[model samples]
Target: MPTPILVIDKLHIGYGHKVVIRDLSLEIREGEFVALLGASGSGKSSVLRTLAGFHSVMSGRIVLEGRDIT
Candidate 1:
């Protein structure tokens, strides 16, 4: 099997005093297409923002290409 290009491991992301996503995890393999599907206020964008390093994490790790980026 091939390795994942992006791995979100037990990510806990949120803003001040309000948690948007907790312990969220997923893996994206190389050349794979994925999407975040949810209703409004479901923290879908929050997860993407956290992966992009826009938000702060309360705990857990974000790994990318076998490296701990978080």
Candidate 2:
């Protein structure tokens, strides 16, 4: 299999002192379709926003195309 185009490893996202998402890891390869499904206030948007560089992650790594973006 080809290398993943995007990789999120041990991602930890939170607001202030409260963590919204913890240890979130994912890998998306070329031509792969991904989706985030969850209830309201489930940190779905937080994850997307972080991926879009909208928010800062508390701790973790965000890699894209073999480069670390976080």
Best by lDDT: 2
lDDT per residue for candidate 1 within 1-70, as digits (tens), equals: 7999888888887778788888888889988999899999999988878788887688888888899888
Query: TM-scores of all models?
Result: 0.88, 0.97
lDDT of 1 at 17: 78
Q: Global CA lDDT of candidate 1, please?
A: 0.85
Candidate 2 residue spans exceeding 4 A from truth: none
Candidate 2 lDDT over residue span 4-47, tens digit each: 99999999999999999999999999999999999999999999
Residue pairs clashing in model 1 are none
